[model samples]
Each structure stands twice: as structure tokens, then as C-alpha cells.
Target: MSQQRIETIQKWLKDQNAEFAFIQSKANLFYLTGFRCEPHERLISLFVFQDKEPFLVCPNMEKPLISQAGWAYPIIGYSDHENPWELINKYLSTYSFEQNIAAIEKEALSVARHEQLQNLFPTFTFVNCEQGIMEMRLIKNEDEIAILREAAKLADFGVEVGINAVKKGRTEMEILALIEYELKKKGIAEMSFGTLVLSGENTANPHGHPNTKQIKEGDFVLFDLGVVVEGYCSDITRTIILGQPTEQQEQIYSTVLKAQEETLHICREGTILGDLDRKARSIISNAGYGEYFPHRIGHGLGSEVHELPSLNETNNDRLQVGMTFTIEPGIYLPGVGGVRIEDDVLITKQGHECLTKFPKELQIIHS
Candidate 1:
């Protein structure tokens, strides 16, 4: 377990007037316990108390792996035949004999689990720990940023592979496969999300899926992909043209690129998150493509692809050093190709670091 993070949660519990809480989300479980796992249908949880050794509750099959992952605490494991919730309640009773207010990651805990928890403790006052955890994860520590930096390098390389795979008749799925195959050869087991290779009119959709469409001259090919390194994730999107562009195509690409570049220039500490979104939006709006840009500026990223502090027009949260997020601006016209330039960024003491350094300048792949 990370002693510092454990203490942070302990203090948060004390502040919330919560006797104890359940950290159920896998991301948070790894953050506090230094162990990451997907419970899938099985149960994997952590019980943090105000003044006691936090206990781990997981499937019996993962007991040894949990210990190997450096969780030095009491563990409650259940076999497939056992009722996990009943076992959890029995152990929780030993920790908190009688309590009314129970703190939990309300967002992560399902309604079914909440019902089960209420069943165990009839008189329960559920306290939401989601805010506390979200606030805590807002800032990235040096170690986390370090891993993120490396992850960003991999994301950039993935974009490069995508660009190189462009050919006269390569299918979108073929390009996607090539990117992943190359990344896997270099030891990337999983992408932060599904590898995306959108082309032609499909690029008009912000979250378009890769398909079997063959490349054609003058088509726009978009590569939106990321990879997980250690526990951190990196996301990037770069749109390129298959051949020389028309006047309108060049204008749209340059406008989107300018919006991204200008916004990134002011990404220093102290900028309001909302203001950043507006700055990018205004640039697109002034260019008469406001309606073409549908999504917000960007979203927070770290252990998960999307997290807290979404960059929208109303959130006034101030960016601080050690925070990491993406600044992606795009313009999509229905029935026409689109352009989106995304970069993973880290707020620094003085300015910011652009982790995904893949060139934003439009690349034209000759037919």
C-alpha cells in the first residue's frame, strides 16, 4: 500500500465524520493499495477505517496475488460457493460494531451493493466519499506523471505507426491492426481504449469506430488511440489527408490546428478550466465552424482514460501544477471530412508539458 495515499484516505474519513469506508473502484483500489485487479463478477474491495489496519476483501483465488502485490494487511477471501456479501458484513461488523453513517464511493458502489449493505446494517447513513476521492486524484504526483510521460511517448509512437500504415487501399481495420501489432511487439498489452482508425465521411463522427472501408484519394484518415504503460494512460488523435487537400479542406485543418495550438499556449497554471474551453470554442466559432465542433475541449486522464474536471464552459476549476489532461479541438462537418488534433498535457510549475509530441501539422499521404 502507498503509505501516503492510505493516510490521505484515513484523514478524509476523519474529516467526513465517517468511521470507515469502502474503496470499491478498481482505479482507487490500485491507487491506495498499490495493487490493481479487475474483480469482473467477483468481489475485490478495501475497507479503510479511521483508526485500524485496512483489510482487503477479494476472491479466494486472488489471495496470493494480493499478497504478492504488497498488501500487508488482513484479507477476507471467499470461495466461489460462499456468499461474499455475507462474509463482508461479518468481517465489517468486527471493525464497526455499531455505526449509523457509512462512508463509501457512492459513484462506484452499485444500487444492488448499496441495498446489500443496507441489509447488513439496517440503520445506515450513507456518506458519499466520491468527492473526496475525486479531489485527491485531481493532482498527479511526480511518480504518476513520470509514468504518464512514458505512456505519452507510446501514444505518439502509435500515431506515427498509423500514419505510416496509410496506403492506396488499406482498410481502416488493417491500419488499426498494424498499430496494435507494432505496439504489442514493443510490449504494450492493452490500449487505453479501442484503437480507432476512422476515414473519409466517418471522421465526421467524433467517436467514430474503425471499419472495413478502404482508403481513397483525398480522404481524411483519423487516428485516435492510446496505450497503457504501467498504470497510467495516454490518449491522442491526429487527422491526416490521404492526398493533397482542397482549399476548403486546408482551411478547416488549419483552423482546427490553430485553435489547438493557441489553447495549448495558455495552458499554464492559474487558467480557469472553463476559460480554456471558451477560448478554443471562440476560435472555432469566429471562423464560422462553431456548430461543427460538438464536444467540449477535453477531459481529465490518468489511471483511467476519462476522469474528473471536465473542460467545459461552466466549470471554473483552476488548473494547478501536477495536473494532467488533454487539449483536443476539432471541427466536423456532416458529409465532409473532419480534423481533430489532441495532445496529452501535464501542468508544470512554470508552464505545461505536451506529452504527445506527434506533429499537428497536416500530413498528406500520397495515393
Candidate 2:
């Protein structure tokens, strides 16, 4: 755990006149405490104070794991049968606050949970702390960039596995399973999200899922997957052709690749973030495939697969050094197959680094 981060949030709480801040999201918890756990339906939170030391509340069973993750603070744990809110209230009630204001993760907290907190502190005024936390997490430190590079290497390996698994008559689900199974052998415990291996017409759908559709000659196979390493994530996408490609297929593939590369070429500090999307969109539009292209250029990547600083045309944020995100450009035709090229990019003092190093050239696999 970084004491500096803890102090940073405490300073923010003081500046906001909030006595304490409740961090409930798993991603934020992992960010602050260095402990990663998926407590589905279980109460787990970190309470930071403006003038007092902080404490963590979680299921009693996870106390040891949290400590093992190097959290040096008071841990208030409750069993499944106990009311976690009561424990939290009893512990926090010891401190007398000058103000009744507290900060909460408005995005992660549910109405029921808000009511529970309200019942505990009847006069407490809850304010949104999610945006503040996001601002802190937006920039990548050297250590974080190191972990992301490793994750990107693993994501590249996953794509390699998927491409090699493609075979005549093999179903899309079959190839997806092969990719994850191979990754597990290499010590990957989890993927950032569902592994996607779309074949032929399935590639036209931006959010296609793997299924029993078999691979065949003259099909465009797309692999989009990522792996999580040490709480960080890497996302990548690559599309390949089975057998020979027609003129239209080659044009679409080349257009998407050009769009991705041109956008990546302009990445650096002080560049308008939205212009990256505009750059890619213009390339696709000039190629007469604008209507077929949907979605933004990309999104920020870090502890969570999809995070802040969205790469959309509407956002006017400037790209800063230490900021990491994806530069993905694609063109999807409804009846025909589509092509996408995605890379995890990190803005550097000089220019930018493409973390995911899997080759982007269109590969034609002989079926």
C-alpha cells in the first residue's frame, strides 16, 4: 500500500470538508490498499478520514488476505451472519467529527447501502468522491507502467494463441477456449474480460461473443482479448483472414489499419484527446466507410479494463505524459466481415509507447 496515496485522499477529504471518505469499489480498493478481491454481494470498504487514521471493513474471512496485501491499518471484519454496517458505525462513531459531511463512491454505492449508512449517521451528508479518485488514478506511475507492460505482453501471447488455434471446421468457441486454456498454463489467473474470437460474419458485430459457428475458407477471424497481471490489465484486438481475401476485404482491412496507425502517430503530450478519435474517424470516412465505423477510438486502461479519460470526440481533455489508453480503429459492414486493430498506448515524455506488441499486419492463414 502506498502511504502517499492514502495521504492524498485524506488531503482531498479535508479540502472538501468531508470528515471521511468511503471507498467501496473493488478497483478503488485495490488501488488504495494493494489488495484485490471480488466480494460479490459482500460488504467491503475502506474508510479514510480527514483528521484521523483510516480503517478497512470487510468480510472476516478476508482480513488475513488484506493484511497480506500490506495494508497497515485497523481492519474491522464481520462474519456473514453479522450486520457489517453496525460494525462500521460502532468503529467510526468513536471519532467526533466537526462536520457531518462524508464522501462516498456515488457510482458504486446502491440506494440500499446509502440508506444503511444514513441510518448509522443520521446527519451525515454524503458527497461524490468517485471523480476525485478517478483523477488520482488517471496518470500512471513508473511502477504501474511496468506492471502494465507485463500485462500487455501476456495479452499479446493470448492473441498469438488464438491465431494459432484457428483451423478448418473449428468453432469460434473452440478457439476461445484454446486461448484461455493456453494462458492459464502460463500462469494467467483471469482475463480482463470475456475472450472474443469471432469468425466470418460474426466479425461485423463490434461486441460479438464466441459461439459454435465453425471456421471455414474465406472468413475473417478476429481475436479480442486481454489478461490481468498484478491488478493491472491490457486489452488488444487483431484480425486475420482465412485463405484468400477479395478486393473489398483487403480494402477494409487496410483502411482500419491505416486509421489506427495514423491516430497512433499523433499521440503525445498536449494533444487534444478527442482529436485522436477524430483523426481515426476521418481516415475511415475518407475511405467511404464512415457509416460502418461506430464506437469511439478507444478508452483509458488501468486497474479496470475500461476506466477514465474516454477517447471520444466529445471529450476535450489534453493527453498528458503518463496517461495510458487504447488506440483502436475499425470499420464494420453489416453483411460482410469487419476489421479492427487495437493497441494499448502510453504517452511518454518523447512520444508514446505501444505496449501490446503483437504484429498488426494482416495475416492470411492457409486453411
Candidate 3:
């Protein structure tokens, strides 16, 4: 377990005048306790007190796994037949704290679960703790950066496999399957999100799904995928062309490449996060494809693929040393195709490092 991270949360709880924090999200639980579990439809939470030792509650069957995961704290495991909340209340009875205030992740807790928590401690006032957690997670440590670097390399390998699988008459699903098959062979058990491999006009949809649409000559294929490595995630997007591209396609591809590369160049410790989005937007707008470019430049990348410090034109958060995110620019024209070039980026004191090192140059796949 990361005593340091747990202490950080405890500090936040103390500062907020909260007696404790109920962390329910799996990502946040893993972040604080160094134990990761899927606990599907089950209760798994971490209760951290401001001045007392914290304990974890999870399904009884997973108790051994939690110990194996290096959690040296008290664990309150409950069987499937018991109400976990009752167990939690029984456990909390052992410790005495101000039953007046508590911190909870407002974004993650469901309304039903919120009611349960309320029923358990009707006198406790719950305040939002998600922002504090997000702020703490914004800056990447040396170890996180190192793991992200490895994850990014695996992401690059995913793109390479997708590129090699691209051929004439191949369906989008066919290529998608091949890429995942290769990644499985490489020991990747999970992807950051649903793997995206869109070909031809389907690429115009930013979040399109892979299907039976077959690739043909003069089609643009976009590979947007990521992999999980040691609990960290790496996201990368690269669009390539099959056969010779028309002048319009070339223009679209080059504009996206320029916008993405130029944005990456300005990443540093003091850079404004939103300006990166505006910089890329301005380029795409100046190139007469502003309407074609939708969505934010990128989002935060870490243990969870989409997290804090959203990179958009409105966010005013400043980039800091050890911050990591993605810089992607794209142009989608309906009925034609789309082009997106993305890279995982890290902000350092000197400058920035692009983690995904795959080529940004427009790759033309002849035949």
C-alpha cells in the first residue's frame, strides 16, 4: 500500500474538517491502496480516517487477493449474503470520530448507494472529495511516468500491429481482431478502452465502432487504441491511408499532423492547458476545417484512460512538471474520411516528451 498517498488523502480530510473519506471508485481505491480489483456488482471501498488508521471493505472471497496485493491494513470482508453497509457500520462502531462530517466521491457514487450511505450515517454531512483526489492525481510521479512510458510503448506496438493488418478487402473487425490478438500474445490483458479501428467514411465518426465494412483502395483507416501496463494506461491515435490519397485527403491529413505536432512543441511546465487546445483549434480553423474538427484536443491519461485536467479551450489549469496527457488533432469530413494524429505527452521542467513514438508522417499504404 502507498502510505504516502493514503496520508495525502488523510491530510485532505483533516483540512476539510471531515472525520473520514469513503473512497468507492476502483481507480481511486487502487490509487490509494495499491490494490486493484474489478469487484463487479460487489462492495469494495476504502474508508480512511483523518486521525486514525484506515481500513478496507471488500467481498469476503477477495480477502486473500487483497493481502496478496500488499495491503497491510485492516480489512473488513463481507460475505454475499450480508449487507456490506451493516458490516461497515459495525466496523465503524469500533472507532470514534466526529460523526458530523465525511468526504465522499460525488461523481462515482450512485444515487442508490448514496441513500445506503445516508441510511448508515444519517447525521454525517458528506462533502465532495473527488476534486481533491483529481488534484492529487494530476501530477505524475517518477514511478508513474516510468510505467506510463512502458504502457506507451505497448500502445505503439498496438498501432504497428493495426497498420500491418491493414490490407485491401479486409473488414474493420478483421483488423481489430488481429490487433487485439497480437496484443494478447504480447501479454496485454486489458485495453484502456474499447479498441477503435475505423475505415473509410466510418472514420468521420469520432467514436465509431469496428464492423464488417471492408477496406478498399483510397480509404483512410484510423487506429485509436491503448493498453494497460502495471495499472497505468497509454492512449494513442494514428490515421493511415490505403493506396494513393486524393489531394483533399492529403490536405486533411497534413493539417491534423501539423496541428498535433505544433501543440506538442509548446508543452512545458508553465504552459496553459487550454492554450494547447486553442493552438490546435486555431490551426485547424485557419486551414478552413474548423467545423470538421470536433471534440477537445485531448483528455488526461493515467491509471484511468480519461481522468483529470481535461485539455479543452475552456480549462484554465496550467501544465506542471510531471503532468502527462494526450495532444491529438483531427479533421472529419462526412462522406470522405477523417485524420487524427495523437501522442501521449509528458510535461517536464525542460520541455515535453512524446511517449508514443510512432511516426506522425502520413503513411501511405500502397495496394
Candidate 4:
């Protein structure tokens, strides 16, 4: 972890008056310790507190890999079969932190793990630390932004391939398969979410999954996908007409594009996120498509696909520089297909930078 990050954690611990914080989420663990270990039903955890170096606990089998990650902390490895709670408790008992409040990741900690920890440390109070950690990571740093930029670039390349794959006689599943293949070819090992390849009336579903229905002429095709790079994520969506678009299809597409463009122009640091959502939604609403635009304008993107500072009417979190998220607005009409345009954007000092630079103009693919 960087010195600045460590200092930030220390300040947060001080403000919260916490003796130590136990982080078990794989993504959070990687963010703090710079060690990328799978949290696969195992008790790989990290403990950090004030005036003390952080400590990592993992199975002995993972020691070599953990060591290579260059974590500036003590790595305590126990046998896979040994009771990890017992080992952790023994270490805790030796310290003077008895009866002190220890913050634990409430959201990510499984019930079984929480019960085990409670039983082991009956004297210490365990409090929720998930929100505290999330607050810390909501804003991106320089290194995180760089990773997100690269992830967006990779998604752009994959989108081009996916758009080209849409053709007459091709199934939605086949188009998705092609996108996945291109993502892998571009070295993206993980997808932020399942690839959504919706066609025709299916496009009315915002979260539609790829199906076996074959593509045909004059059908609307929507591609919503993202790629994960070094634990950071990027999301982008584009809608295309398989053949020539009908008059109504063209109208809906133009309205959606105008809304997205206007919202993008107004996005900047300190702007109320909900205001951005409303700006785009008002356009669709005035055009009599408000009911079709059901979901929020966008969401924060980072280690986990969805983070803090949601772009919605209910959220009042002000945008800050270094924050990266998506700006997606759509108009979905049931039985009439839908049109959506989305892009990954980085909040900058002046305005916002569009990371997903792939063409958003409606493309007409011929047979």
C-alpha cells in the first residue's frame, strides 16, 4: 500500500477511536494491503490499528504468494486445517487491545465468520467498519484512475467487436460470445457483470440477458457490458439497429442521444449527481418516455462494480475530482424496443472526461 493510503487509514482510525479494524473483503484487502488473494471461503484477513504495523493472516499455502505481493506488514500463516479463529484469538490476547472496540467489515463478513469472531473475542466489542472503509475508497486516487482509464479502453475495443458481430441470422448469445472472446483477446480476464445482448422487444428490459433469439433485419440491438482491469471496472452501453431503423426507432434513438449528450456536457466536479440524472430524465419525460426510463442515471465504478456516490435522485453526495463513474440514460418502450447510450466518465477539475470514446452514433448494420 502507498504511504498516503496508510496515512489516510490511520487518520480514519483515529477519528473513529477504533483500536483496530479487521478487513476481510477480498477487494478491500487488496486495496489496503496490495495483496491479491482470493477470498474463497477462506479466512484470509488483515488487521490494522494506530501506532502499529498492519498484520495479515492467511493459510500457510498462500504465504509464498502473499510474500510476493510486497505487503509492508507481518504475514502470519496457519495450517489450512487449523482453526484460524483460534490463531487470531491467540494473537489478540497477547496484545493490550482487550476490551477495546474493533471495527469489522459487517457487510462482507459471513454469519458463520461473525459468530466465530464473537465467540473468540467475547471481551472486545466488534462494530461495523464496512461503511467507514467504503467512505475512504469512494474517491479515486491517481493510480486507480489510470487503471480505470485502461479498463475503459479495453471495453471500447470489445464494444467495437460486439457491434460488428451483430448481423442478420446471429443469435443474441452468439453476439455475447463474440464480445467475451474479444475481451479475453484484449487480456481482460474478468467482466464487471454478465454481458447484456438484448434484441428487438427484448431491449425493453434494462437488465436483459443474452438469449437464443436470432437477429433479424430492422431489429434494435443493445449491448451493455464492461471489463475489469486490475480490480478496477468500466461500463459502457450502445444501441444499434440491425438494419435500417424505422421512423419511430430513429426518433427514440435521437432523443436518447441528445439526453446523454446534454447530461455529459453538464457533469463536473461538485455537481449534484441527482441533478445530472434529472437533466437527462427531463428530456425523456417531456418526450413522453419518462415511464420507460426507470433506473438511475448512473453509479460509481471501482474495485467493486458499484460503489458509493450513486447518480440518483435520492443520493445527495457531491461529485469530487478523481471520481470515476458511468453516465447512462435510456428510453425503453415495451414491445417497441429501446435505445440507450452510456459511457464511463471521470470527474475532472473543469468538467468530465469521457473514458469510453467509442462512437455512440446509431450504427446501421447491413446483412
Candidate 5:
């Protein structure tokens, strides 16, 4: 499985005119090597070339695990206190890559590491490879899509548990506990983000953390959570009303749902992101909730909760088939509550496919 990904990366490196590329980002490393490692002050980096086999440089303690993964690459281990620059320089010299241009992940490479590399090999040239690699990962392959689908299914089940657990006197923290418990029950080891269970006026905060405030009758209940399954992530949000919703709340909920549905309808391959965002924002704005809708419509999702090809009015990138992202639109009223409905979407040649199958209609749960 990893061999195919390595071959694909090699082809991409050749096309980009890169002599060699270094990958240090934890998520990218997992994608390329199928070996997961915790990120720490001690860096574990991988080097790949167009024709040669990939090589990994890490602390001595990690060699056993790396070897157990059955990677067909050379593993170079160094002492914990030893300078990694010395080992890297020796390896490069042995490979006869002196003075060659090397592509480095500027986003992940620290200034300290950069300085060490420069000092070790003053003749070598370093180029920023972050964008090149990110572009390659933007589109999801078949395996990646399958994992994301499973993640979405698990997230839907978690949402169902959270909604049912909502009560008039339950605290926001209790609701979050129920959501996480349900996620764990479905075999989700880690969440894409912390569970957000906001009630009443606290729902107005888009990224607010759950607190101990008890939910009141006739208050809005917001849930934004996701789970990581097989390295891919699934993110979704659903808002419900406790008891009965007022006329204004009902109107706001309807407007947000309409915006989400319209956006999904127009999102497809070859569509401009800016236009897609406008289609959703225009619906809310036309409904007289322009100021309430402040954030972007959505963002790309994959190994990371947020990746590239953001969906917003400012983004002009054209949508391509196999791209996956979220479509979340909300309205926040200060001193009141907010309503946000989000789902995972995948772009296809024919049109857009909604991966999240949760009900979008506002649920009125009597306390």
C-alpha cells in the first residue's frame, strides 16, 4: 500500500524538477510511510529522491518501530544527544549529493533546523517544498475516500447520541461527555477537534469550548464535532432546539439550512470556489442575516481537520474532482443563540456528493 504512494510521490518530484525532497510534517509522514509517530522537540525526517529508495533519520529509540512497519527504506538512527546534522551530512556525502538542490518543508522545518542544515552543508541549496507537496495531497484517492466515508458514518452516530442526551438541566460539559463517549463506543480513538457543546447565548461563539452552564428550556443546542478514522477526518455540526423555538429562531434556522442546501447543490468539479461561497452567503444575506454570517463557508478536510482549497468569497481556486471539504454556514445573534449546519462534501465529475447523511431539519426536543 505504501509502495504505491511512494511511487506516486517520486513521479511528482521528478515533474517538479526537484532533485530531492524532505518530509517532516507528522501527517504527511504518516501518509507517505504508513508509520505514525508523535511529534516532539526531537524531529524525525524522511528524505526521498526521484530514483533512489526513501530514507528515514530518527532517534535510536524509534528504529525498532520503524523497522517493524516493514518499510523498504534505509533507517538511520542517531543518539538522543547527538547533533542530527552530522549524520545527515555524512549520509548526503555517501550518496554523492553534494551541492544538490534539496526541497524542504518550510512550514514544518524550524529555523534552528534550517540553520543547522546550512552550517553542515554550505554548498547545498534549499527550496521550499510545502506548496508542492500540499498540492499533491489536496485530492483524495480511492482509499482515502473510503476511510473518510467511514469516519463520516461514525460522526453521524456520535451526533445522534449527543442530540438524544440533551436535557433541560444538563450542563454543556455533560453533553460533551456523552458525545465523546458515543464516539469512543464506535471505535473512534481520537477526535478531529474537541467536542463543542454550546447552549443558549454561548452558541453565538463559533469555536467556543463547552462549559458547566446548564442548558435551559427553549435554548438552542449546538454540536460541532468530528472523529479521525484511518488517518482521515470527518467534521460535522448540528444545532437543535430545546422545547419550542421562537419565530425568530425558526427563521434563522431555516435560512441557514437553505444556504447549506443551495451551496451543496452548486458545489461541483470545475466550479469556482468564490462563486460557490457567494451562492451560500447570498442566500443568508438576502434573508437579512448578512452581518451574522461572518466566517468562511467551509474548508478542505483530510489528514488534517483543515487543509487547502478553502471555500470562501476570497478564494478563486476552481474546484476539481476528488476534492473533499466541509460546507458550514451559520448565523450568530449576540445575546441570543446561533445556528450552524455543516456537512462533509466530496466533489465528483457529475456533481458534489454529500458524505454526511445526518438530518438537516431542526429538531425540537421537548424537555
Candidate 6:
């Protein structure tokens, strides 16, 4: 049961010598409890005690929705006109447990909220619970992996839609809209992140927003997007040529594909996480494009779009079975264009399996 996830939090609090936990992060709240919502500045939190049953605290209007989502526990709702913290103090009084010593997710709780909690219990001591919860979310379970697999397929579908929409004079936003419109037609609730469509020289800005930049004949059009399904997520990036590829464009695309593939080949259980980035960095460096590759190779993904076990050169952690992440490598030449090939994958006992199976053989969209 998902309730056991709260039990795990209880055990963690005891280990940390804390008797209570105040969870404020929506991601952690959804991971422990099956319900997810964006409170949007209003107070929404979960209160847990080591020896008592936990209760969910949310806005009064969301009570029915949360119950329908299957949270079979005590829930306290407060209207906009009421002080939620005061009500929280009243609920703690019922448990007969001292709330003086506690652990809280300092990462998610705001300074104003922390001050309010302090005003309620001036003598309380708070410890950090972020690492413990992140450790629990690091390795995904079977059910989560199943949903991610399904989400990955939809991400591939989005890429196909984007590829089909690529044509001379088509703006990046138009392609972006067509991809998302097609996805929504197929029942995808939302994208894991903002759908990225960068054309021509715009692709050189790896993190650039999709604007009205129009693609042209022989321009390199890049689509980096993802979809969220069942609270899990999938991310994939594919760059296509809009007509006959120039010799320079072909060389750059081939270099990025090789770097990404070389990294993917070593994505197996027990491999050092840092080694994966080094392998890709080495290949790109040898090709004289080292400076063009700026960001880390990839990051962990699960119920949240980004989680722990980040893939970079500084981390010495070894890959473990059941861990999932992305292997994306690219080179961006200033004033020209960029090429990035990314895929979501899971490390297995034997090897690795690609969650996104879209072909990466230099797709060229005819003008």
C-alpha cells in the first residue's frame, strides 16, 4: 500500500531522532501519498508523527478531490479565511505527542511558513528530511517503471508528430503546437516539461524558448520534448534536417549521435555514473567540439521530472539496477546550429533497455 511510504517516513524520523515531519514539497507529498495537486501559494502540506497516523492538510475546496484520489487517512481542510497553521496545532494536540523535536523538508517550506511554524512552537527543533526522502525516490519500483515505459511511447509519438510538421517556413511555435495538439488529442494530460522546438541558428541555444523563429530549407530543426502520464514522465530529444543536409551539418549530427551512442553502450549496472559523462565528453573533445558541449550528460527521472542520482563528472556513484535516467549528448556551434540526441533508459541486471525507441539515424524532413 502507498501508506507504507508514510511508514517509511516515520522510521526515517525515528532514525534521525525526530518525532514529527512536515512535508511541503508537492513531489514528496505525491510520492508518499497518491494524490497530487499544485496549491499555487496556498498552504498544502502533510503532517506525520512517528507513533501516530499521518494526516493530510490541504485547501478546503480540494478535500473531495483528494478523497477521490484514494487517500484513506485523516485529512484536515482549511478555508482561505482561516489560519491553517493554527488548525494544524489543534490537530497535533489530539495525537498527545510532543511536537518539540521534528524533521521537516526545509527545501520546500518557505521562510514565511517556517516563521509561522516557529511562532506556533517556539522551542521546536527542526532537522532536514530531504536526503532521506530523495534516497527513497532514487531507485524506482516496478510499477513506476511500467508507467514510465508507457509515457516514453507517447514521447516518441510527440517526436513523430513534430517531425511530420517540419517544413520550410514553419515557425518553431507552429511545430510545437502541432506536436502538443496531437498529443492532447491522444489523451496526454501535459508535457513533462515545456515542449522545445528550436530551428536553424536558434537550436544553438540549448535552453532557448520556442519563439517565432522560422525554419528554412537545409536548416537543422531540433525537437526536445516529453510527456507526463500517470504522474510518471518521459523525455526525448531528436534533431532533424529540413532538407538536403550540408556536409558540415551531417558531420556535426554524426558526431553528436556517436557521442550519445557511446555513452548509451556503457549504461549498465555497476558502471560509475561519472564514467558515462567522461566517455561522451572524451569523444566530443577529440572531435574538437568539447567547448560546444556545455551541460551535464543527463539526470535522474521518475515521478518527478528530475530526481537524485544526477549523471555528471563530479559524482562518483555507480549505476544500480532499477535506476533510470537520460543519456543525451550534443554540440552547439555558435551562429550555426546544434544537434542533441537523447533517450530515456533503465539500467538492468544484464544491461540497459531504451524507454524511448525512436530511430536516431539522422532523420531528414523534406522541404
Q: Residue 15 in model 1: shift from native, Å?
A: 0.9
**Residue-by-residue lDDT tens digits, candidate 1, 254-283:** 999999999999999999999989999999
Worst 10 residues of 6 by lDDT: 91-100
lDDT, candidate 6, 142-184, per-residue tens: 9999999999999999999999988888899998999999999
Q: lDDT by residue for model 4 over 78-108, one digit each (tens)? A: 8868888888878777677633677898888
Q: Residues 60-111, candidate 2: write the lDDT tens digits.
A: 8999999999999999999999999888877766678789998999988999
lDDT of residue 314 for candidate 2: 92
lDDT of 5 by residue, 166-263 (tens): 98899999989988987787687899988899999999999887899999998999999999987889999999999989999999999999999988
Q: Against the hidden true structure, what lDDT does model 5 obtain?
A: 0.87
TM-score of candidate 6 to 2 decimals: 0.97
lDDT of each: 0.89, 0.93, 0.91, 0.85, 0.87, 0.89
Displacement of residue 311 (Cα, Å) in model 1 is 0.9
Among residues 3 or more apart in sequence or in different chains, the pairs in candidate 4 whose N, CA or C atoms overlap within 3 Å are: none
lDDT measured at residue 55 in model 4 versus the true structure, 0 to 100? 86
Candidate 3's residue-wise lDDT over 1-367, tens digit each?
A: 3799999998998899998899989889889888887888998999899888889999989999888878899999999899999988887777766558989999999898889989988888899999999999999999999999999999999999999888999999999999899999999999999999999999999999889999999999999999998888999999999999999999999999889888988898888888999999999999999999999999998989999879999989799988889998999999999998889999988899999999989899976
Error of 1 at 115 (Å): 1.0
Worst 10 residues of 4 by lDDT: 91-100
| lDDT, model 1, position 188 | 93
